[model samples]
Target: MKPVSRRTLDWIYSVLLLAVVLLSWGYVIYASTVAAQRQLRKEYPDKIFG
Candidate 1:
């Protein structure tokens, strides 16, 4: 088997890093939204939408 070239390795590293950053960002937003909803529900248990 042949070793990967430096340029190919750089590209792969860049893509992986970008994917991690994007997924982390997306997860933060999703988690915050869910947390907010939970808080709202707790604060307003009698509300229908909550």
Candidate 2:
């Protein structure tokens, strides 16, 4: 097998960084939505419906 080139390594690193950023953003949004739901439930305990 041949040695990997610097450019290829850079590309792989960039893709990994992008994936991490996107995943973090998604997690933040999901967490915020969950927090909002919890707050809503707390403020309106009797109004939650399935």
Candidate 1 local lDDT, 1-50, one digit each (tens): 89999999999999999999999999999999999988888999987653
**Per-residue alpha-carbon lDDT of model 2 for 1-50, expressed as tens digits?**
99999999999999999999999999999999999999989999999744
Q: Clash totals for all models, in order?
A: 0, 0
| Model 1 misplaced stretches (Cα beyond 4 Å) | none
For each candidate in the order shown, give its overall lDDT on alpha carbons: 0.93, 0.94
- Kindly give the stretch of ten consecutive residues in candidate 1 with the minimal lDDT sum: 41-50
The per-residue C-alpha lDDT of model 1 at residue 14 equals: 100
- Looking at model 1, residue 49 earns an lDDT score of 56
Give the number of the best model, judged by lDDT: 2
Model 2: ten consecutive residues of lowest lDDT: 41-50
TM-score of each: 0.83, 0.88
